[model samples]
Target: MFRRTFWFTAGAAAGVWATTKVNRKLKQLTPESLAATAANKAIDAGHRLKDFAVDVRDGMAQREAELGDALGLNDQDAPELPPQRRIAAIENRTYPKYTYNRNEDH
Candidate 1:
């Protein structure tokens, strides 16, 4: 009875090992399946990038229109301003000192 039980356990282990080897061989036989999966992923990524570009362009146009309205100018008449010039204007007009206390102590 003990010998029979040992043989049965060994057969089950061998069956599992053989099944894994067959599965690996089957995957190796189908190269086109792997290539198709990679191509599909690339196409998906390209579509997502195109969508993002359209969204960014739309947002920038909307923001420019709003800024033109606030400045009391038509969108076509709005003057183009560089970011650096705007920053410099704000920095020059705004005081940097935090307090009027000129004394070093007290």
Candidate 2:
């Protein structure tokens, strides 16, 4: 009688453990749970990307300042211009024009 009781208790414990594991897996596979996990990963990636962009911008600015010091350009002489003024300055530069003659053979 004691042996039979022990076997029954062991079986019951195994069944309970198996049921708990299967239920946990099913919960993870549900649509809402899957979407929430994916969204969390995406938000984490976005934060990492933002931090990387800020670091790159800061490094570029530091390099620019170092180059200015090497070239003996002071802040007053080389004031930082807004995007519109920079575009205008680039557009205002003059380059020598070249004429192309297709009929001339070399």
Candidate 3:
């Protein structure tokens, strides 16, 4: 009789454990749970990507400053790069406009 009772108790415990596990798995598999998980992961990825972009921009600016120092760009009397390389007159050159006479078409 004691053996039967022990078996019965063990079976009930096993059944309860299995039911709890199944319910938890079902909750995780539901649409709302899946969508929330995906959204959280996406937000985490976006934050990481934004951080990477910020780091890259900072590195570029630092490298640019280092190069400028090497090239004497910070000196007051140093010739500038792009400003001195411009040709303003060629950019401003224009052609005379020709008017069409109606009497010439005839």
Best by lDDT: 3
- What candidate 2 gets wrong by more than 4 Å, as runs, is 1-11, 79-106
**Model 1 poorest 10 in a row by lDDT:** 83-92
Better of 1 and 3 by lDDT: 3
Kindly list the per-residue Cα lDDT of model 2 for residues 1-106, writing each as its tens digit: 9999999999999999999999999999999999999999999999999999999999999999999888877555667666763334466788999888988757
Task: Look at candidate 2 and give me any clashing residue pairs.
Answer: none
lDDT of 1: 0.85
| lDDT, candidate 3, at 60 | 100
Better of 1 and 3 by TM-score: 3
- Each model's TM-score? 0.45, 0.58, 0.61
Rank by TM-score, highest first. Answer: 3, 2, 1
Q: Give per-residue CA lDDT, model 3, range 1-106, as digits (tens).
A: 9999999999999999999999999999999999999999999999999999999999999999999889888665756566556556667678899999999997
Better of 2 and 3 by TM-score: 3
lDDT of 1 by residue, 1-106 (tens): 9999999999999999999999987885687877887889899999999999999999999998898789866655657776764444455576687777668557
* Model 3 lDDT, full chain set: 0.93
Order the candidate numbers by lDDT, best to worst: 3, 2, 1
CA RMSD of each candidate after superposition: 12.7, 8.6, 7.0
Model 1: pairs clashing at backbone N, Cα or C within 3 Å: none
Most TM-score-accurate candidate: 3
How accurate locally is residue 92 in candidate 2, as Cα lDDT from 0 to 100? 72
